[model samples]
Target: MSRIAESFKNGKAFIGFVTGGDPSLEKSEEFILEMVRGGADLVEIGIPFSDPIAEGVVIQEANIRALSAGATVDKIFDLVASLRKRTEVPLVFLTYLNPVFNYGFSRFFQRCADLGVDGIIIPDLPYEEKGELAEIAAGFGVDVISLIAPTSEQRIKQIAQEATGFIYVVSSMGVTGMRSEIQTDLKAILEVVKGVSSIPTAVGFGINTPKQAGEIAKITDGVIVGSAIVKIIEKHGENAGPYIYDYVQSMKNAVKELD
Candidate 1:
């Protein structure tokens, strides 16, 4: 079974996140390897953008550093292609709609297919605006994962119905970052997602600890931790892999509690 599906069947969903050119492409590769070994069922590699308005300070800085280091969309694809040699765990590309458009949707999805990417997550692509890209992705057998915010209810159903693979349930109303606690009623939110999506539902945003991951896993298919992992990369530099491995292992152990 694919690691993602297997995790869901085992009553636990894997945590995944977008790691842009933060430390460096080479270092990020090692970090991804560690994530898999540390029990990540999937990995979302972020293609750095110049105007990352949806990210927090930490992530924005990481993106800049990545861009400054010459991390291009093409380079990101090459890294993803190389990753295919190491594992079968699903790899999802996370980016803004602009870059996808610039690269040409049909060609991008086709290349992603060739590279064995399981999915794509375009944060700015609304369900109402995804007609062309969605059609092309479906034709290429690439899953188009969609997101739902705290305020979205009716729209959530539409996104879930049209979305492939697992749905990314944004745990907060704000942009991506670490938080003290996700103040929203995630249980109610998950129920809304469950009502529309036959696919698994994974919660993200503001999750930073195993305790939080365990709490969310009780009612959802998975948990996604981002800024927390990025911060580890920031602090440990080249040692990011070991730090991520340790954190992910802790989250994995916590999620296992639900099983």
Candidate 2:
């Protein structure tokens, strides 16, 4: 089974996100191992880009730092290639569509397949325009994951049904960041998702605390934490790995409470 699918099988999946080449590629690699060791069921590596519209200030700065530090598409691929030798955790690229277009879609997916990447989450690519990537991804064994917003009331059924690996259920409306409280009707949103398909759903955006993760875990298949992690990297730099390891473990423990 695909590592992503396998994660859902195990229980509440704790998906961790980190920008590739944040402080440095070597540090990013260390962070990935720490995340896995801390019990992250899946990891989303942010491919640094010049403009990340879906991200809030935390991740936008992370992108800038990574890009400034010379994190290129080839370099990120090489990083993952080396990582594949040591671990088989589900690795998904959380990137914008422009990078893929510039790199040549076919070649990008080809390299991903060769390097054992399990799936991809392009926040900019809406469902209507996913056909192009989906067609190529199918041939290369990569899942072009889909996202369902809280406001996607009308299109939730359609989006949920066609989601490949898992559905990324956006917890709030704005760009990705940590929040004090998520006031959206997530239970109602998840209802539409569950009614439509069996594909697992993971909620992201504004999930910083263990209590928050546990509450979301009650309804979704997994919990995705991003900006909170980036803050750790920003504060600790190369030494953030150990702190991230403990943070991820705490989050994972929170999700385990769902059982």
Candidate 3:
């Protein structure tokens, strides 16, 4: 089984996310390592893009911060290689279609395999359009993860059928940001997804607190947290490690308590 799938086997996976170079590569590495140590079964690192269509202001600003710090695809790949030597946790890249295309699909997926990245998430790559790189990704042993939004009612089953790594269930209709509450009919959505695919499903978007994580865990295999963690790094910079550990630990604890 792929490492990402293996994570869900233990319990509800706590997937932590942070833009690779939010402030600096060194700081990013430090904080992300803390997240792993704290109980992140899997982690998604953003490859900062100028126009993150699926992202809200929090992640959009994080992209700017990373870019300003000299973040590049090549640089992020190197960082992942370095990080791989230290941790066995599954690492997935959260990026856009443009960057992967600009880098060349075959080349990008090859680089991910070389660097130990297990999966890739291109939010803008629709289910119908995923064929653009899905074949190439599989050739390199890198799974192309699918994102199913609330609007994707009929398509959820189709997506789950061919899903490779895991299904990223987008909890809200809008972009990535912490919301006061998740208003989507995810319970019904998940029922369809679970009925069709055996692959694990993890909900992302608008999850910030442990309460949110615990609540969502009841329906899905995991929680993907982005904005909240990135916001912490944006405020704390290099000293964000301890805070990341605490937050991830709490979220993990919440999931465990549900069990």
Largest lDDT belongs to which candidate? 2
Best by TM-score: 2
lDDT comparison, 2 vs 3, better candidate: 2
Clashes of each: 0, 0, 0
Question: Candidate 1: which stretches are off by over 4 Å?
Answer: 1-7
Higher-ranked by lDDT: 1 or 3: 3
Q: What is the per-residue lDDT of model 3 for residues 1-259, given as tens digits with 9 covering 90 to 100?
A: 7788788888789999999988988888898899999999999999999999989998899999999989999999988988988998999999999999999998999899889999999988878988869999999999899888988877888988999999999999878898999989999999999898888999999999999999999988999899999989878887888988999999999987776
Q: Which residue pairs does candidate 1 place in steric collision?
A: none
Residues 10-71 of candidate 2: C-alpha lDDT, one tens digit per residue? 88999999999999999999999999999999999999999899999999999999999999
Clashing pairs in 2: none
> Predicted candidate 3: what Cα RMSD to the true structure?
0.8
What local lDDT score does residue 184 receive in model 2, on the 0 to 100 scale?
Answer: 91
Candidate 1, residues 24-58, lDDT tens digits: the string is 88887888889889988778888899887778888
Q: Looking at candidate 3, what is the lDDT of residue 233?
A: 87
All candidates' TM-scores? 0.96, 0.99, 0.98
